[model samples]
Target: MAAPVITVSNKSLLHDQWQLLQPWFSYFDADGNPAVRYQLWDSGATATSGYFWTPTNAHWPANTTIDVAASDISNVWLRSGSAGGSETLWIRGFDGTDWSGWATFTFTTIPNSLPVATVEDQSLHVNQWARVSTLLSYSDANGDAATKYQFWDSGTAATSAHFWTPTNSHWAPNTTIEVSAADLANVWIQGGSTTGSETLWVRAFDGFNWGAWDTFTVASTNAKPVVAVADHSLHVNQWTRVGSWMNVSDANSDTITKYQFWDGGTAATSAYFWTPTNSHWAANTTIEVSASDIGNVWIQGGAATGTETLWVRAFDGTEWGDWDTFALTTTINTAPVATINDQSLHVNQWVKPGSWLSATDPEGDTITQYQFWDGNAAANSAYYWSSSNAHWASGIAIDVSAADLGNFWLHAGAAEGSDTMYVRAYDGTAWGNWDSFALTSTNTAPVATISNQTLNAAQWAQLVNWTAASDADGDAITKYQFWDGNAGANSAYFWTPTNSHWAAGIAIDVAAADLTSLWVQGGTAGGSDTMYLRAFDGTEWGAWHSFVVTTAV
Candidate 1:
């Protein structure tokens, strides 16, 4: 009879299920009968006795009908345990009296299945720490209560992995772990020098061997600090309270430690360094900068006028951020001070006193206006007179008349008889303090004397030295008038002065016609003639005096 055909359904099973007969078979008995019985055993001689099949009861009755209609064998046995690897199952079937040689089938028993591993991507910044392993997952299909896992970088051995369970120790499936910076650094440094994109690889290992490596990119992210100033414009020598704000952030949540300041593209180290009170680097933080600080760093640094640039940067202990820039303009506005070049003036004089008024501004500002006062008075006071509102306004002409001096004569109480004139300047902003000087006014009249002289009646002799005049105020005697005893009768006989007499240096002259008129008025050439002489200054005339004139015999 043909050996009963035997067919096993599954060729492989887990070693843990070795005690149960999971394999199924189908066949017909050699006696043409449907009844059959079977047994299973290891085919390899080196195989352990555990691979031998054992029956709880004696081998089943040979006539037990192996139902052909049923597709599988139910009670095939392996009382002995099973080992993982290729194994052979030896089976024999029998009908009541006839025996069939054993039919052999080969199958494999697998060890505990390899643990499956997966990892997640991550992002971090320089000097920042994170748990990379927490992003990993592991699983085992064998249902092995104890499955071990280890972490490793790409191109690295599991023996030298970042972290692993103790030797011979195992962890349950789906276990989680946190990979530290030091643990990652063991294979590769995270966040290579710059701040951008990067990648990391991780792999897992079961207790016996390592699984395939899995890759997850680690994005290295870092951002620069943004900075700005409250005020971009400032004045030299002006004290201003300035503030600064900053926006700083890191992907890894790093803390900002300090700040640096820059002036004109150079670091403001040494005495110019500014320290902040608030350790927290954030927006709207008040950075108190005194006016003195501006003067020392900007104004004193030769940025007296125009705009200058300033820069700021933030430090996160390990790295320095990009520099943020701002602008600062320096300005100057100082009032001008004026002084009278000529300290004294003469009253009744049309003087260019304004030419004597000098002014200066510390900021080199142009003098736009000037005001003058007759006496010592504060500028912008009711009594002050506004001069020309033009550039160099202090250089205009001014008249210190007797009326002007007289007004101050009592107010000044000058023993030397002098009035004070005050002047101040304006440089488009405010007026300066008044500067003063003294002025003198006088009304002293000239004294005159008569000199005797003879003149020929018909011969026409010229009269000499008819009169002399002098004034203490250095005023010129402009004219002279003379008359005989009958002043109204000898009106025509009066001497008329010329241009030479109008000068302060020359004396008045008497013409020949005046001599003839004088002689005729005298009634006779031989008789002495009486002439009245007087001098006139530009403003007033002197007292009259009489002089004698004689005709030659």
Candidate 2:
């Protein structure tokens, strides 16, 4: 048989206080309350059948009302017979179609007693205690039988709720946990397991039933503390100021600044002068240097334009004795070499009367001192123990320049011989006779060799080693010059490792790297234009003298 349609006055009521469906004949108690009896079946209007047991809280008067929200799903029942309660109604609802009943109940009954709030009591800790519950739970005074406990913050229940989260919420029995960090964003709840870390919490409940989640948020971050210092340098021309320092180190205080001095990218160790000790090395000090103090400052050519390095350093005092050195470069031009006259002078004639002298260095090393010496030998004089003939230019010429004449004689520092100072000339083609002149050397000059000394790859050449070349007046031979005929006077370049620029040595060594298409020249006196190289082999120094490598190779 089909269950009969039923009706009731109130559609919704206290979920705990009422129940509406009754399919069979039922009786009323002495107070006219619905009887908690049940019948097995339904026949005609007599209506029998279907039995139910009475409920524990079915005795509520008809006028009693309570909220019908999901939280109030228990605490109500009706008595059916001597067995006591039959059914529990979640709310007053029995429309004809659906007979689904409701029961707002607790698995664990609410305790007969209720917890009381004190000035301060925590629920989860030893010293502190609290009374926490969902909106669904109620005290015996509210006709309910379950009890719960948790902290209740003076702030909103939400505060108390989210605070206990990420902690003991899931344990069978609630627990207490200490808070780690304060809520920079939301409450910070710390919890962990014996194994490791547990999960975090999203929401908490304070009422008998939680309405919606009151979500907690993560906190903002804090910056880390650090200690630091700063350095600054100022560069002006040649000098560098490395120690004017100002520092802001940390949040609390500033740090002291230390400084160092460097030359050509290298630092000086000694603290000759310092405001603060250079050893300890601290801020704000100056080392002054003159722009002109930078000597021997030169840069190698061949790098890309403007890619030159400028090096600078201080020379305590002895700049000449190897001081700090630096090299600086510029797009500036090299000193110009200009020619006025035809660049040719006859024997016994001056070199162009007087043309202005001009030439510059790539980095500008001064030509303060000049020399002009005839590169020839005296009568009966050997290559060693020779005469003073270092005039920067000798009677011989490996690389002779038109400008070299002025550079050799006038610019060079050498005394005129007893006869006269002369220069052998190469006028475009063949070698001319000696360029004669008048001058007085204190004594008779030593005889010199003037002969062709250059040779072919497998050819042979001779060498001349003789006695010490003594100066009549007593002047010592500071230096001696010898050139193979391969290097001619006035040529642009001279052979190397064998040219006339060795210290006065009794024996000299020569190699083929020094052989050239041109030959050496006689001095201003004009010696033989064709002669092998010779060094004075004074037995006083050592009787060692050698000719060109061409002699052996």
Best by lDDT: 1
| Local lDDT at 417 for model 2 | 34
Error of 2 at 430 (Å): 61
List residue ranges in candidate 1 displaced over 4 A.
1-5, 13-23, 27-37, 45-85, 94-101, 109-127, 132-146, 149-205, 209-310, 317-322, 328-553
Best candidate per TM-score, number? Answer: 1
The window of 10 residues in a row where model 1 has the poorest summed lDDT is 407-416
In the range 173-256, model 2's lDDT, one tens digit per residue, is 123332322221222232211112122122222223322212222221112223122321111121222221212122212121
Q: Candidate 1: how large is its RMSD?
A: 40.5
- Model 2 residue 550 lDDT? 26
Off by over 4 Å in 2: 1-205, 208-553
Query: CA lDDT, every prediction?
Result: 0.47, 0.27
